[model samples]
Target chain A: MTSDLIAGTPAATGEGPQEMRSRSELTAKEVLREVGSVLRMSEKEASELTSSPVENDEEQTMIINMGPQHPSTHGVLRLMLELQGEKVLRCKPIIGYLHTGMEKQAEELSYMQGGTNVTRMDYVSPLNNELVFSLAVEKLLGIDGDIPERATWMRMLLSELNRMSSHLLFMATNGMDMGAVSMMIYGWREREEVLRFFQKVTGLRMNHNFIRPGGLAADLPAGWRDDVLTILEGLPPRLAEYDILMTNQPIWRERLQGVGVITAEEAVALGTSGPILRSTGVAWDLRRDLPYLKYKEVEFDVIVGSYGDSFDRYAIRLNEIRESMKIVYQILDKMPSGDYRIQDKKVTPPPRARIDESMEALIHHFKIFTEGFKVPEGEVYVGIESPRGEIGCYIVSDGSPKPYRLHMRAPSFVNIQALPHMMRDGLIADAVAVISSIDPVLGEVDR
Target chain B: MSDAVVDSPAPAEQLYGCVVTYSRGEKVIHASRGNYIATLKKAIDDSFTMCTDLTAVDFLIYASTNRQLPSDISGERFEIVLNLISLERRERLRLRVQIAEGEATLPTAFDLFPGTEAMEREVFDMFGIEFEGHPDPSRILMPEDWEGHPLRKDFSVGRIPVQFKGAPS
Candidate 1:
């Protein structure tokens, strides 16, 4: 009698509304086969199916691959997500598609040319990479104190600007990932202005290789002050527009708030840093804590988030741009006057004019360029507060022209570890939000 | 060499009996070869919660005879360098564990700081140093089918010559 009833009403087999609707939508042949299978099953099995339709349907978790080429991943970062219905059970971020072996290549390059290599690691924050590598080399050389005052201020200025540009990129990409299309346009517009200034100062849009072991590539170009001021003055209004567009928007709030929450304990355990670690309410900025470069002299607040949610991460990065601008303004006001590169003839090549007149200057230039400066046999780890986090360069110099082993403790690589913890038991959609909030660059991750 | 000597109290002094302290440039390094895992576990318990980096250096060619290592510590062909930081104390400590050329096994630090999981895998992939008890021990930055550890000093550059479309192969 029960089997006859099941055949008559195939969709009414004690399934939930969702399961029932899906069952009803199936083709006649599928329904017939399903009914036939149900009829052949025991009464106990039928009762179990009817009692817990949702559970029965979701018995098997679906494994879905997010990307190694997906646009939302920012670069070639593939995330294998195990999903049960709409929720993600586990996520594994598979990287190394963009592995350029930059660290291996750094061993072949001399210290003078090392800046150009490390700069390409975090392509967005090239200056920070160059700065950390140079600082490590300088520390090995035991000449950290001898770096000229003017050069220090210039590095500070350029780094802060680089931070602003990197954060701007985050704001734009984060907006696009969360479905705010206009932010893509607005974020790029402001970033383009910063890039224009970078071009004028460093002579490249990206991977400038301007910062060197001893000092900067050259002094700040003519009219650099006005160019910097123009960017500083131009950013606030656009930031206000961002606030209206994303910060106050209900949809944006709904998608981000209380989503991808990671506690301070989890963040630290996973070794996540930069904004991701800061978002967990840990107030542990390397700039403030370690006090590298001239960060000690400058006054800027470390923007920290309380809940450590995706929203907090977004808000922190947006507010950080304002803080970086503040630092840039301070650098501008206190711009020191002197040689941009160090005056040490062994480290720095002589001026173009000096090379023309003096045979000694020409010979010094040739030697420095060809043979390169040899660092003392030692290993030093220099960690700087990059826009991402603690971008450290661990260099082991064997008293050679080239580093024996150059290891970059890239923040992106560390921060990506937290993604599995963040995505665990969260909806598949939230996984996208969480990854976007992490703001990882695959170049650094794979390298 | 004198300037590299850290006057600060050595935190890992109690953990290992043979904890040799030396200065490498401006940084103070606490080095040990045997019982590497226990020393690292002690460091973690002593507020070195953050494992900033874990990398290995192959000193095949650059092993200078005038190396500044202490007399008690024997040098090896490969050395695993671990950088740890105590966030509360705001102090950084470096630990170097020397692994012999043929024997490349070191106990994992993943149980201490879960962050070292990927770093351990990277060390294994690049330098061929195996971390025992690692949750996922596999090639991180290289393909699984890769022949040799690329970062070893003995590993060749593995250069592939480039050819233009219309030019000779």
Candidate 2:
């Protein structure tokens, strides 16, 4: 019957028999006409019908909004998903829900106050944010090499610990997203211990604001070494417990092992960094590649993954916690004894005792506080290997007390671009796994 | 400082006719507005596979007093900065394109490096420098209905006075 329609149609149109008979062929218009005849409709009416190929299917696919407030979306991230049954054909990440205009605000604040501003961007890794900002400011001031050895060591110790804590939060949230509720408790418990150490050292748990342009906000507490040692001792066994809890569990492996796979080429093209890029078998850790803050002096390994899947990303962060612990221990062993901040008089305030005894010291302190020191006119871009990836600060100074322009090359912001690339062709159920695997701190993403 | 100078084989002057390159504290390439795309393509082909950052600095206020660029390169009101890194060589290079105020659009780097798509959009959103060929050239971090570019130097730092509930009306 189909062959009769094909032959009869070509004959009606006066087409060559040899060309028409090459195969059972009909143009889309002819096919529509044939369908029109089958449905007892006129050719004009059939030709007027317009529908997408997907709509022509027996079962139509659906479009769904995942979240600006869904449980599995981590923070305020929203995903607009196009789904065919359970499969996600296309995904668009709708962000900017947490935008606070912090970059614009940084311009009004002085360089001394800049640390406090940037430290809040990636609240999870606040010290890394502060460290990058300080480094950029120092580079603009041309005092990159003048930072005290003790301050450098302290910054390394605090930053690695921050990395550990950030990863621990990821372990917890990632576990919860995958339905392992107990891991939430375990992850937060370990993170609480790290936060306690941070509180003791910098007087704030989350946003320490300790790592400043010249040096740390204050000297470390006398018992900091032992406190960190205690944290170091407690983490290993808990890490082992997590391995037993989720790493080798059958269901965990089933959900993450082959899901959200992205190749190295795609990852780099999308500008994904941190675990997402490392999981794609690239050993590009900025800590090692572009060493800053005495990172070159420390000994540690850059953890990498074989298959760029959700499981590899999870495993890389888990192993990176161990590497960070190694770096922290090395910092403790080689703790330098010197001024924590540079005593340039312009950048740092004079000693408290000297401020009371000497008028010159008192004036220096007053000037440093009321009118912050000016940065030389220039611009510098300094990128550091934060827990998420390359958290960079691009500072353009105008020889004023305040920064001319300060912009953060937020790792979470850049890494989130890889979402649609990773989530394409994956199931809707696996979308949560993919999003959590990216470990996006929306504060950083939106800032 | 003279001993540390490592000259590029294809100098900016030789490769692109109008563009000039300078190293100030770091390697910086100064490209004219018209040759921005070609200069960037050369940098990309020279193994600068990663674009670490792309942003602009509005020199409207600091143009004359604070920064003293060579007279030939100093007059532009806005300078779009591109920081590129070569992963293989562990090296960094900076490209500064002096875009005049009237014609603030430059060719998009999306074709050379897909990563710059978001960064370019950000520059457009904040500094109002349009990328001629950007695929989705829309406000990224800001709301769609935002009024003016916030990062421009002239953008007012709007301050809203706080009002207490029942104290004074």
Which pairs, if any, clash in model 2? Answer: A67-A78
Give interface RMSD, every candidate, in order: 20.3, 22.2
lDDT for residue A243 in candidate 2, whole number 0-100: 93
| Residues forming the 10-long window of minimal summed lDDT in candidate 1 chain A | A12-21
lDDT of 2 by residue, A402-430 (tens): 99889899988888877877787788889
Best by TM-score: 1
**lDDT, model 2, position A166:** 95
lDDT, residue A95, model 1 = 77
Q: List the residue pairs that clash in candidate 1.
A: A67-A78
Alpha-carbon TM-score of each model against the true structure: 0.87, 0.86
Top-scoring candidate (DockQ): 1
**Can you tell me the DockQ of model 1?**
0.22
RMSD of 2: 12.6
**Which whole-number lDDT from 0 to 100 does residue A264 have in model 1?**
89
Q: lDDT of each prediction vs. the true structure?
A: 0.81, 0.80
